[model samples]
Target chain A: MEGIGIWGVPLAIFAGAIRVSTPFIFVSLGESITERSGRINLGLEGTLVFGAMTAYAVAVMSNSPWLGVLAAMATGAVFGLIHGFICKFPKVNDIAIGIAMMQFGLGLAFFLGKPFIQPVAPHLPSIALGGWSSSPQIQSALNINVLFIIGALLAVALWWAFKNTRVGLILRVVGDSSDAARAMGLNPDTVRLLATAVGGSLAAVGGAYLSLFYPGSWNEGISSGQGLMAVALVIFARWNPIGCFLAALLFGGAGALGPALQSVGVTQGYYLFYAAPYVLTLVILVVTSSPTRSLAGAPGALSITK
Target chain B: MTIEANIPTLPPLSAQSGNLRPILEWLARRAEPVAISLGAILTGLALFSIFITVVGKSPIDLFKLMYTGGFGSWFSIQNSLSRAAPLLLTALCVALPARLGLVIIGGEGAVVLGGVAAAAAALPLTGSVSPIIVLVVMAIAGMIMGGIWIGMVGVLRHYRGVNETIASLLMAYIAIALMNHFIEGPLRDPASLNKPSTTPLPAEYMLGSIPGMDVNWGLVIGILACIVSWILIEATSFGFAARIAGGNVRAAQIQGLPVGRLIVGFTALAGSFAGLAGMVEVAAVQGSANASLAAGYGYTGILVAFLARHNPLAIIPVAILLGGIDASGGLIQRRMGLPDATVLVLQGTLFVVILFCETFYGRFKIFNPDLWKRTA
Candidate 1:
């Protein structure tokens, strides 16, 4: 305490930011892709929770955390597949469908995952980026999860791909206008279907990071609104993948406020501090939204911005 | 079904003896929604039965237990009605805003805050004031608090173009957090060591059951609220304007309709119902504001509203159906050794199947009268 002095709180928060932001990054990036393909999946929260359950159960059963990740991705893809297929029908409200899917996913997860709650699953490995630092505090603070690094790189790659790739062009065309995508001879529905599945899979990876990594565990209270928060994060990022990475970091930092305060013995109103991310997101929305104009870079056909 | 009975014969007939198109068209139009809802609910139940069968539980036993526990006996019916009381109001929370084309899913926020407000408002009035005065004050306080909480979502949506669904959800999280803060901090009753709730109301002031039944006054209030909401939506110019606005906001605005006010008013009114539910809980059930006030009734209310197709009158039957399912949960859990989440799964399956069935509306040409019009 004496050696670290005033730096301990900020250091803990910095580490907390990186650790906490991993899930946000993955979910938001997935949401961005889905939105870019002219659809939105609010049920990602359900997917995230179910993914965590699947990951934890699989890891415990198979004795390998990576297998758990694959299992979660597969389950999440199926959830998306159902959502995408149902939404493709005429007059079906995707938002309402998303809500229904969320409820169904949550119910199924809770019912099925009840068995795996007590077991100890394998944890995901982390990278030691601070070998140069001798202090145990510094070493622990700089220890980063592999998923975080992968998510960061994926963000960069997605940003570049959205600009340069033919797939990106088709997605954008489908998102902006189905008629235009049809003119280009692309089936917008099929593209959106794939995009949604990919999005759900990415969100599941985020969930795998949750149960297999930091604060890792299989329980009902594992998710504290991270899935829903990703929607806000994607909106704040203006649908940019790189922006999602940055925004996730910001959200993660805010999420660390409570624990950081607790570390310093300022424990009063801790729950309020836990609400910082939501408050921040709400404030961002209130400030940035305009009635006369749609959000800049928002997918043209996105139901949310419309 | 009631709507079908109440509506006068609108299609003019030539009485040409052989022309049955108009009559058939009218009946088809009237029957489509009922058929869809019924079909979807059955399909959902079938899916759940398969899941249950796969798990080695007999679906027949489950449904039988559900019927016995929910609607079989007078006591069970009373239990179902009691639970349905809160849902009636909370369903309005989702239904009203829906008429304005806003999907607000955060009624839970209003419910918690409303309950807290009711308990807090009643705290000082307990001993000195009469029970009736205290109850009225608490109800009003609860409504106002809930109104403000959800009304803020409508305000944000209209004034700032914020997405109502996300805004309402975020606010609900914030509201719950705030409720917890207050309950565990300033409002904590020192004597309530285990639960950490506000001071409980006096026994006399607590809401009592109706004279002849085990059901509380909340049921009657809920029924009345539904009727009033129906009248408001169906019989008034305000509701007409709201319907027009919901159909097309741009068109409504061009016609000089008060779209913004309608949005705010309907949301606030809807939220007040959810708040009143919280108030009812505090007064009749919990006797204080506590963590239980944030129960998933708000979420279930969303299902009720959607099942009813956002119609206030239709919410009555839907809420009762959901309430019966909820009441039977305990029975199913006890009799079958199934977990409590079975009900949630059933609900989720039903909700998904219903949403999928939405594509079926107007799909059948028989339901569309224009297609049946023969050029005489």
Candidate 2:
């Protein structure tokens, strides 16, 4: 491979980060909303995979990638509904149920996705942000997906809504204290159920991005635990949507490090770089965690914090 | 609450029933878990049938194929038993840590690392060492690596207040990555060009089949490990302390039990069992550490542990049951034209329904002798 200039690696990483972080951004933002409501849906891994399959299958059948995204969102919401309803019952551990749901989703996807694997679906449209640049490398690298822009806007909107909207306040109140919500005559279960449903839909959008955009395809190995990592990303971001977006970019950069280095002909420990997100998440968790006290900004009623 | 007062008064049940009272009480005491678990299994089956029906396959045919492939003949039973061997140990990995109220789901990491460590240990003594000595060294290496792998999760949870579930899962991912790095790099055998793997064990050093059985010694070892773990958990003071800590960590701490030590020790032991399963796979089955070593035994073990309610002894039967389900996958695919993921769907459904049924526990007064006394 011809060596790119010294600045090429960094530039490549930046471009890769943008291309790769879309799913992370959506999933983490969704998880942030869900966690903000005091419930953890570890099963998002399943939701993400199922979404990828649904999106790919629908896009192939309908010849419309946008419809694929919508179908995935609907499927994801149904999964979230199942999770939320089951978790509503007393003594049902959300985390375990999440794992079970993950398996179910993955199994269902693989079983159903057998045919879609061989067919090609239309890729999601992307903007030629690097059209002005002379370099093809930069041009291709900077071609941003529309979903990335939408994800950024979603993050900003969520951040603003969490502080300014009455609906957001109700969600926070329900998350902070179920008793308080109940005292105010609000059914905490309903609120949480809805929050989880919305979260699930958002996460499916992330999956649609994966299958219909960057590395666009339907495969069992397409998602390397991105859904699960979103949970950790949410924590590191302190449950803030914009922070999730930024953290996702950081993770995407980490994920891109190996490919960028390999492009630059530095192949040593390439496989290890795939673990960068997980390791970073672990470090962040350890640093933020306190043995005697819950992390700052953690919802009062969150099972993880307790 | 209202129903208790409405019960018809007759002779005290214990006095009237005589010997039957004790038997009935015993049955009632155990009935809750049995009934709830059976209900969960049936519900899961029903849901899975609907899924199967939706997919244009007959659920009756699928179930029939599962039974025939899993338990129909002597050969099928042997296959299921062989598959259940690793699960026995891996399930213990979850069951033991669960005794300390920790959810350590990363046993897969330990299994992968342990297999790598065992392979590395055996490579040096390929020809010179006694086969038995080589096996011992491999087991020790595997156990230590596995122990440290899971022990870190315990230490992080207890000292740093990290969530055991997430931390362990992340560690598992890291461990798999590291294993891949080694298998594809430093440890790669030149002969393994198509698929990266460590050096295979010599034929003489490989674990052999048991007498009159097609299954390897791993099955026996797994059974023995379960027996030992059961005794350790149910009959010892340390186990008693661990159970107490599991119930209430503050109470255990107040009672001067070393809660941190218990957590780390139990997790380490659990990891070691999982690690042993890895070694057994490499030694008795695969004969080398490779990508295949990460064959999801760790994940399946989670289902087994939960289905068994994290009971060490109960894990034996549960592991076998799941193993049968797994063994039937290929046959179901071949015969019914359904995908191999069919069994996975069943397992996942069972897992969800079973966890949901946890709410039913302590709900029925008939299952609680204490409630009966109140009525009396």
Candidate 3:
């Protein structure tokens, strides 16, 4: 910002967007998969926090970042399993339960996570995406993390499976109409339970990314509703996995705006910048949630849709 | 597809005992919820005890300490009651809109914004206005801001088809951001360098304790608000319209009720109550606005609201019970070397189990008096 002229603003915002979108991509995709199975787990925020704590703790203890990821995944799966079982009961409101589970998860994490706050865990390595650039600034800007690629790949895979696979067909059938699934001699509850577990593990991976890579440590302040935003991202993406990936990147970009500006030497009113991704999400929700056109890929049984 | 081919038709009820419905129906309605609540609490405690044992603690000692620490003595009872004051209003925030079938869980945003608004409004009249007038103005400003915030969510849900749950949450994030901006910049009391809070109201001007009690007047105000809400929901036409809409939205529309207005009105009223909680926190407890204003009360109120089945009158006792648990956290921490979050874990566990137990309400034949004949 000192000598780079007026172009710095947009460039900084673009850079910030990439950095911030990482967690969003992971969590949103996880939510997309769970929601596709007819159960909405609102507690992913807690999962994200707990995942970060587990990853950080494991990394510190074993000196292996990959092991941390695995540990986090296991932790997330257990959380998901609890949610699935509780929701399977008759007349239970999954959304309210999700909120309760979130609080429970956060409490447990805070109770146990107090010990791992100060350690330097093994961090994930990044690739130089901007290697072609000669300038140091450009080279640094191009250093993209590995998790982003993995997130994108997962989204594509989920999209394809959702379209062509029998398992995906069953999930959609269960999500669309449980009575229809019942008629087909399938248990809707079992499918949803498995889906929630899978979704929980994926969301934990997102949490692993937060602690093992970006923001790069476990602490109480690590996540600020990236888990909850994933739910909104699913709606914007119309519950398409691939769309969730792109939407997450967009959210990440919004999240990065303030920090990018701060890094480039414009630190005025940084709090306003922090509100960017949430504001963007609200705007997108209002715009996309119109009564006029049919939401092209919406699941028939979704409660959010009128 | 296979099950569709088979059916066993059953006839409707026409028994002698069913014919004498009024007296039995009244008794069953009163007993079912209490029985379910007790059953759920026992199951929750058993599950939680397992967790405590795994962590190398005795559940019996924990319960004993929690009870004594929270409500064993007169002093502890007052302490628990003090905590219950804010909860009462926050619980109302969720309870009110729930009647209209909208789940508004973003009351923390209203509480924070309302507190900030109250402090900001009072800043100008710091020395000139009478303390009573200033407090009234603070409450009004806080309530108005809160009402408008949630009311907007309700409007968006009705007119634009936006999901109120997400919209309200997003709005809450925005409100917090705004509070941070104002508190850290424009509203920051230069003298409060350590904590970066708004200027504190002088002690003389601050809200004092109620006569014969250590707690402030917030408790009375919150209880009065609950009573008024109960009257509105149970004894008025507006409440009736909201209830009808909650029961069958499409049918309510067919009946020519202004569904949009009721939705927005109920949510707005709910937000106002949450905002009033913030105001009371400002005027009664903190005597100024700070980060403490967003203390997870709003989220906890969601649990309280659901646990009470969104019943306005039922919220009072439930709020106090939860409050006692919260207040006991400090004592348990000191006595058992447990983490402060133990109470939070207990609350969360209880909430999850209770909600899951909603499935059991009419399932058992003995509990359902109409189905009792089948057992005989």
Candidate 4:
């Protein structure tokens, strides 16, 4: 903030994008997986919040951040399992079921997280990538977390896997048509169940990143619908992992607009800028989506896009 | 829509039983939702009881407190009723759009913006006009704001093929942000420093309650809205067209139905009810627009709408029942050392179970009306 002047806004926004975009990257990538498997889990918001609570609580108890991340991943998987299991039943609406699961996860988290609100937990460490910079602002801005690097690599790996792996082929097949997957002697339900669980776990990692890094706190207001926003981001990304990564950064930048502008003394009506991400999401959906046809790259069996 | 539960083709009772078979079949068809929903509640309560027991709290005491707080007495009943008022309107928000094959979860945003709009409208005309006129203007302003907000979701769904559920929810977050902008910056009452709020309505301008009642006028308004909505959907041609579109958009298009207009109209109408709920809160409860306007009545309305199977008439009892559970939250917390979110847990469990029960409908032969026909 000091000595940066008006140039601080864009620099701050760029730095903030990298910092805030980690959770979006993880959740959108996870949602991309679940959507590709033809089951959209809108309850990932609940999973994200519950994962934050779990990670913070576990980190406080075990005095280990990595253990907290693992614990969060475990609970997220369980949440997805429950969602996937119930949705497997005929006549059940997956979207509604996701809403129910979200409420359940939120209730469970708040109830159990009552005790851990006060205890400060050990947080994840960050790598200083701006050692060459003499300015403290730039240096501090470049102090990126280890989880973010892992997320970037995960995006590349997932993109490759979706193209080259056998598991990817099965997932794509099941997503396209349950009947065709069954014809190929594959259990669509099982594949979707596993995909949803993996998606849930990745979403939890995003939550862990929030609690154990970035803001580094555990509270009820830790998430501001970012979990839900990831659902839209997945669509904006066209279901590609690399696209999801880029989309996350874009949304992250949009989200940071309000705070970044305010830092440079442009506080007038800046709260409206806080809405930039949502407006951007709406615009993206409007531009890309169509009334008569399915979105390009959307899985054939996905209930939502249809 | 979820309200379209198919009637059983077979009679639930045998003709060899008695002359009461027809009556029994009628009862069976009508009572199917009631019976299943009741079972879901019991199962949910049982699950919650297990959680309570595991946490070392006595489940019996919690239930007793809930009864006293929610429905065991007249005062609690009034409390529940007052709470149910807004739920009635917000439930309509979900129920209405649902008829057009849309899921609009952003009703909360509509409610928030509606309150802001109502407050803004009243601020300019408060002293210039009569109180009743102010109130009427408030309602219309709220409705218009809410309608436009949710109508956008409808337009997006119809014109752009956007997923209404996610789109609506995104709008809600955006609404909340805009609301904060107005509340914190533009509409802040200079005298009120601690909690940011709009200019308060004068005491005479506030909505009063019914005679010999603790509840405000919002409850009656909510009830009337529900009845009108029921008639609109069940007895009117507009409702029929909406239903046809809901059943199949392609078929409706083929039949030359104005499917796009129907979608937008239903969603706008639904958003109106939710917006009205926000106006009620401003006029009857809070007396001003503030952050509390985003008090989650919209989300709870979703639960009520679903539990009622999206039937406007059924939304009445369902809203009251859910409101009672919400009213009992504080009691459960004080008596059982459990957090108030215990109610949310119960609600979530019930919602899940009720949805799962959809699979059971038309599966059991005992609930079938065609059985009596065969036996006869």
Candidate 5:
């Protein structure tokens, strides 16, 4: 703690936020897409963990981090497909089924992941944003991973496409009112299913980022609740892709608060800091649920609205 | 077959047509849930078997080990019963709330906090108070802690319109952090250095086993609690009001039922049951509060409650059955080269399949007495 200057704290925190926000950005953007299409997949947390395991195993075995990312995307799509198909059934509660799927997904991952915990995996490379800086701390803080840029670009692309494309209108119409889509003879279920698959794939890419990039390893403890937090993050973001990107960064910042403090000679009550993101999530939910004003851009058919 | 032969024949359907038809239909309707639940169980078994086959493992061997490890012998049965004890209370934690249409999954939080509170209470009373009095006080403290925790969720749902499911889950996560804080910081026992735990209760003060059985007294208490819960839900006005409220909020409010009170009361009672589960784990098993208090019982209770169709009496058997499956996990891992999480996979699969089968409740007419042709 002695050699660190006053600026070290803020700089390290910024770097930590970028490193941590990568997963949240992917997951929240994925959720925002799904919610925009009038469906919600609460099982993405499971998908994320499973994706992490799949990516870690693939990267470890084949020494191809890129292949690991693809494998994770495929696995996530399969999970999303199952969630979509089951939710299409009459009388089935999607929320309850989401929880069950989360459990099942986690179980299957742990069962299959038992042997891959110890192995090292191929890591994603980082680009230094502060190559001109003289201090190692400054350079480290500026070193951004590839996923961060990709996530930012994805958010921009999605925000643009959702407003400009024909498919976006169909999705919005379906989400706003299934009856209107039915009147237009469009299959609401099909649109929702496709949206969910795409969302699941993106979330898996986030998981791949966890395993093959930051913290680069295959282990059971790689994820905590980053996947679950994305649900809250999407809500905080008001269902906008760009909003998801910023919200993810904020959540990532909060997530790193504890570790960052520890790094800066504040080690007591580490558990309290570990709880910051959840607390932030809970507060956001409470605020959003208040009756004073409607959530700015809530999908009309979203069941979460009271 | 001999048992059926020895039984007296029931009267023919047509013999008492006018008076008996409604009664028979009523009975048949009452039987609907059990039939559907059984169908779901069968479906789950089929799915599980398919999974085993795909993995190149013999389902029969797995089933054999599950049964043998769960109930074949006296020791195994006792072990299963011990596991079932906390599950009974935890399942009730979910079941009681379902009567009021609340899906409260934060029983894990209540259990963890309850155990911590109970231990915290017991520490000061160890010297001056009689062990029995201290234990009773601890139980009360445990129940109070749990009740307040979940009751808060119910209150939020009633007044603030918070979703109980998510709220309770968030609370559970928070409760775990709180427990970890206490165990690692304030309540750390000096002797137990590596694993943080509260000071252990004296041996005499700890809960004992039931006479003539190796099972602890917690099993009896759990069974009794279920029976009492069954009576409360089935035979009380409060239960009736809660059910009405659960069916339709607008209708209940129109009928002048205090929906808010019912919601809060039911959730509080549910929390107490879960809290008691934590106390039992402490007093009977662990004899102290530790990180193990969050052991997946709270989550398992959700499956048990659903499997029982939220029936308190039915939860007893379902919890016992799940307990048996849980007891066999180690055997599956050792003998079949399966991961420890194999049991979790089975449980998760069963849960999802059963919930899916819930849609089939009234689809079959053969099971409905009203659809039965005249059997002269």
Candidate 6:
């Protein structure tokens, strides 16, 4: 604390932003994909928590973190499938079902995760990008996890595929108008279901990142509403995968603000500072939301926008 | 006299003929919700039993212990009642707004803030004011704070078109953070080292039990609140308007109903109930505002309201029933070697199944009077 100079706070925040934003990146991107399909999955919070538990438990049992991640993705896909199938029924509210699914997922996780709380599972490996740096602080700060890089690449890939692929065209059509999709001889239910499954798997990977990498551990309190927040993040991102990535970073930076300030001996009201991300999100929503009009880039079939 | 005799007067109808059809029709109308909910609960229980068996536990023994712990004895019943007290008010937090088709799940935020506000308001009056006055002030403070906290969600939903569910939840997180900040910093009681609680109310200032019963006044207050809410929703024009709005917002607006006001007003009223529950907890249970204020009662209230189908009167029975299940957790944990989360699992299962059963409503021809008329 004594030897570190004026650059300490900025450096800490930059590193913290990267570390915290990784999960957000994955989740927001996942939610972006789901919402783009004209459906919203608020149950992602439950999925994320359940995924964390599954990852941790599997890691402990199989002695392999990768296997644990795969298990989490599989469970998450199943949860997504349930949500998609249930919501496919006429007069069924997606948002309400999402809340119910969230509770179910959380309950299931807590019930099974009680046993995995104590055991130490292997952590995901990191690539030390700061090896070239002479200062130990810089080196430590630059040790980025592998999932962040993968998530970034996935965002780019999704952006590219949405513009160039036939599957992307079908997804866009199904999301924008189910009636149109039917006219085009496509099954909107199946398309949305598959999209939601993919989204859920992606969100689970985000949870895996949490338990296997940064702040890495298997615990009931691991999520703190990150999965839910990602929904709002996707809104702020305006349904674009690249925008989702940026918004996640912004949220991540806000999330890291308190720790960065505390690192520099600014401890007063730190708990309030911990709420920066939520406050920022709420403020953004308020500013962007219009009572008379739907959001600019919202999908036509999205119930939440309506 | 001859003209009067020519005017035929039929004999008075029998009592059975006068009342039977209406009663039958009422029963027919109510049969769907009751039957569906019962079926859902049974299915949930069966699923839970299967899970228990898979985990190597005997479901029969667990059920026996649950009953014994929840209601088998006078002591257990009292415990269940005490637990149900907060639930009644919190369930109203969800139930009231639900009438207007708004889902406000942030009652937990209101409860925490309300508890903190009550404690803060009580700090200056310690030993200087009448206990009853202090209690009244605390209740008002709690209600005001909680109402404002949740009213913002309603306002946002109507005015800004923000999603109420997401906004309310995010606000809940913020409220918790605020409570933690204040409790640990500005409001920290010097004597409280580990838990970081506010100053405790004196024993005499604390709420007392009924003359002969062990349960505190919170139980009575909760029951009274439920009755009052029931009257508000059932016997008032305001409730009628809200119900109309819930059924179809466009029609409500076309009828010139103040939809925005109704949303804000109902949400505020609901928040006040949750706030009152917080005050009751501070006065009757914890005696101070702390992290313990978030005992998950607010979230459980959502389940209770849903289980009751968002009817204020129905909430009473559902809250008590769930309270019994919650009260049985410790007994099950101790006797059957099951984790405390087993109750949560059961609750989650019940919530999911009940919601899924919502699709069953109005689907049966027997429940529809129009269909009955066609058949007749």
Which one wins on TM-score?
A: 2
Location of the lowest summed lDDT over 10 successive residues in candidate 3 chain A: A290-299
Chain A TM-score per model, please list them.
0.96, 0.96, 0.91, 0.96, 0.93, 0.95
- Chain B of candidate 2 vs. true chain B, TM: 0.93
Compared with the true structure, what per-residue lDDT tens digits does model 3 show for residues A1-306?
345566566766666666667778888887887888878899998888888889889999999998998999999999999999988887888889999999888888877887788879999788888888666656666677788778888889999999999999999998888899999999989989988888888888888888898889888879878887777788878899888887787776666676667776765587786777678778878877764543446776655554
On residues B172-257, what C-alpha lDDT tens digit does candidate 1 reach at each position?
Answer: 88888888888888888888888979999989999889999999899988989999998998899999999999989999999999
Roughly what TM-score does model 1 have, to 2 decimal places?
0.93
Per-residue lDDT of candidate 5, residues B63-165 (tens digit): 8988888898988898889999999999998999988888877799999999999999899999888888988988899999999999988987887777677
In Å, what is the interface RMSD of model 5?
2.2
Instruction: Supply the global lDDT for candidate 1.
Output: 0.89
* Deviation from native of the Cα of residue B350 in model 1, angstroms: 0.7
Task: Candidate 5: give the clashing pairs.
Answer: none
**Clashes (candidate 6):** 0
* Model 6 docking grade: medium
Model 6 chain A is weakest, by summed lDDT over 10 consecutive residues, at A1-10
Q: What is candidate 4's lDDT per residue for B1-376, written digit by digit as tens?
A: 1222246453444546768766888988977777877787888889889988998888898888888889988999999999899999999999998988888888999999999999999999888889999999999999999999999899889989988987898899899999989988899787767888999999888888988999999999999999999999999999999989888988999999999899899988899889999999999999999999999899878878877778899899988988898899988888777888888887788888888777777766667765434553
What's the TM-score of every candidate structure?
0.93, 0.95, 0.91, 0.94, 0.91, 0.93
| Candidate 5 chain B: worst-modelled 10 consecutive residues by lDDT | B1-10
Ranking by TM-score: 2, 4, 1, 6, 3, 5
Quote the true-contact fraction of every model. 0.75, 0.67, 0.68, 0.68, 0.42, 0.54
lDDT of 5 by residue, A35-133 (tens): 888887878888898999898898888988888999999999998888888888777767667777778888888888999987888798889889897
Per-residue accuracy of model 2 over B259-281 as CA lDDT, tens digit each:
99999999999999999999999
Candidate 6 Cα errors over 4 Å, as ranges: B1-21, B373-376
Best by lDDT: 2
Of candidates 4 and 3, the better by DockQ:
4
